[model samples]
Target: MNRYDHKGVSHYEFLERLHRWLNPRTYLEIGTLKGGTLRLASCPTICIDPEFQLDVSSAANREVTLFYQKTSDRFFQDHSPSALLNGPVDLGFLDGLHEAETLLRDFANLEKHCRSNSVIAIHDCIPMDVGQTTRINNGGLWTGDVWKVVPILKEYRPDISIFVFDAHPTGLVCCTNLDHGNTILDGMYGEIWRTWRSTELSDYGFSRLIEEANIISTSRVETPEEMRRYFWL
Candidate 1:
């Protein structure tokens, strides 16, 4: 099995820099877990998680922070993101369910609440090894099959722009140029799931994915100005 050598900055550090560069008016995050990334947001923030292990008091940078202690699906079903934040999401980080189909659904739902320029970041899209790409998490450092979403988006939602960063541990996928009105992904969810649910990294060409992803180094955009230019912020 092939291994990905990611010597760039950690995802957390990259996200911190991203927050400063984007200076988003509103931020949304799924799978808050320990709130490591949630604390990075200094704007009006909405966090959804089935169970949160972090202390909310630590996110002192934000004046307005809303917490929904539930699954992303449940949160979306019960509330509109724009209504909750009083505007479309400026930046969103999706680190919820590790399954590709779940991530796809999360993307479809979240995009409807975003503007054309809004940025959405997906976690764990670049698995280091095939062992960590299994649908079920067997042990440490499991990314599940979330990497499949990269190709799925490339094939299905070609209108959007996707960029993969070589952040440590796994990788981060940032997507922009969104069309909230687009329903192609939602309409084709079943077919997409059927095609990708059983597929593995080896079968899909892991090396090809790494090569074609054109993963960018975090070191190149260490400063906010560099990030602004790279992402056209």
Candidate 2:
């Protein structure tokens, strides 16, 4: 029996696979945390976080990988992700504020810097349980309100394609069908926040979100080499 039948690949492995396939020159990640994820990129990387506890022990210390100690909100307001990249951001990760509203805002901002080939991955989309999705942030495996963005994107931005990798712990959502010129989300930002900003999911309701998201499990990847095929083919 395949181990992936009962378990998914770790998020780190999933990310590394994506980077290996994309071979992007620029990567921008929100929420640096301990630099565990940041270390995976051997390309130009920009990590933004208000507070980062970095550990570069077994990580790539690329001269191009930079840390911007600022909130995503401030970072976007003051700096351009593409400017740092000097072109479109090939790979962008939204692992910052776990709130749905914040995540939505980050997604919109990131989209402004994306080209047709861009893929932006949003983390913490799968909450462990009802308690884990709450805004209070109590549970050991809390996912916060980030899951709300799944359906929001599906409803408002039908042009975009959303896929969940279902990696270890929370999981990752990769978005394609990027439109740098799209302004629908920005226009409806307030209404979206009002709709999904304070969502609380029960056990049954949580399953519905998965159904609504139409997320693909990492088991679809089959093997590390197959990831490139899975994403592109």
Candidate 3:
């Protein structure tokens, strides 16, 4: 039950032990820019943010509730009421408007107000395929087209279970296999998102995943020719 903030440490300690073993009632959070993960989430939070322009009175004095939909697909395509959702939110934190078609239409408009074991955490789905990088896709959580909505949610929800929680500069997908785990909190499920194939992204398979991500990003320092052969120590 630890939700440390300072904005880092992989999914806030497993999202605070899955929000204290799923004690959720409703806490949908698309992207509360300055709320710091909505004060490390607990419950009763609804922060949409379509250019919310902050100063929300310190996030409404910490009661944590604000919705300024400028375009969650035109507010759930005009179904309004912040998208006709008034129940069964439980947990859904996609870091808002991250391209790839608005993060796959905000997960198909929050998958119709999710519930049957609700918990959808998707943010910056790690996919920076080498250089030519141009960031600023804030609404697409920094492009990579939000990993193409995980194969459209595994071809229309095949009892989801994709994992990947690097938590660095925002990277977490965790869908959690619903069915085979028998839904909700049962055995406290955990397996965040993961899956790959697009002909394994060829072009010599993305030039060997960018040459193995540049040899694991230059395999740390301590030896870049021992500091370029000690330029003069």
Candidate 4:
């Protein structure tokens, strides 16, 4: 019943395709190291990061694009890029902190600026193993329990639609149907973070979380095509 094939496409390709097809008016990225992913945005954009280690001269050339060398917490504390954007967050990417608590906070902050049509892509959700999901950076590629934020939003914020797909190295989670006015997840940030921090998931628990959240894999053709149509122009 779907129409598009998302096979053989890298995350960069997928993002570029979305930008080309959707032609969003504004974009935001939480982690803008070196500007690799941030460069893919085709609209007026905002990049937030505490530090940078890459040459973003090309990205900086975009007169509409603004770079804030600050943590998400610090950036959202008083600043609002959506006020300057044409629409309530056309698209956003969250790739900072790599911790569930920090990610949850970022998601909550982004939600304040997102509309129902806005889409958010979160990187490094499906870790290869338990060690990769640990709080400490013990592995070569650190995801750092950021995967937990998916289910946290799924269970607590059912108003939104959540999707996960294989993007190599780790994974990607795409969320839409956002409600900027929802206050259910407000004011309980510390409590939610503490609860999820204390909760440990077994392998089975992980599978259950995926199922409960209805996370379909791109390894399956049906999921990708459905997502394509969901975001179709």
RMSD of each: 1.3, 3.6, 18.6, 4.9
12 Cα displacement, candidate 1 (Å): 0.4
Q: Which window of ten consecutive residues has the lowest lDDT sum in model 3?
A: 212-221
Off by over 4 Å in 3: 1-24, 28-31, 35-43, 46-54, 61-89, 96-142, 155-157, 160-233
Better of 3 and 4 by TM-score: 4
Top candidate, metric lDDT: 1
Cα error of candidate 1 at position 224, Å: 2.6
- Note the Cα lDDT for every prediction shown: 0.89, 0.79, 0.50, 0.74
Give a tens-digit lDDT track for model 1, residues 17-58.
Answer: 888888888999999988889988999999998989996564
Tens-place lDDT per residue, model 4, 1-233, is 11112233466665665676667778899998988888787678888899976675645535588778889999999698678675588888899898788888888899889888788888887665555677888759777888788778877988888777655656677888888888777776776777777765554366565455444545453344555665632
| Global local distance difference test of model 1 | 0.89
Deviation from native of the Cα of residue 152 in model 3, angstroms? 7.1
Tell me the TM-score of model 4. Answer: 0.85
List the pairs of residues colliding in candidate 1. Answer: none
Candidate 2 Cα misplacement greater than 4 A, ranges: 1-6, 57-61, 222-225, 229-233
- Model 1 spans > 4 angstroms off: 56-59
Query: For residues 1-233, what per-residue lDDT tens digits would candidate 3 score against the true structure?
Result: 11111133455554554455555666777777666666666456667767765643444434546465566666566553323346656667777755545665566566556644566778765454422112344343244445545544655566665554445444466564333223322121122223222323323244443233221111121343432221110
* Model 1 residue 125 distance off true place after TM-score fit, in angstroms: 0.6
Tell me the lDDT of model 1 at 231. Answer: 65
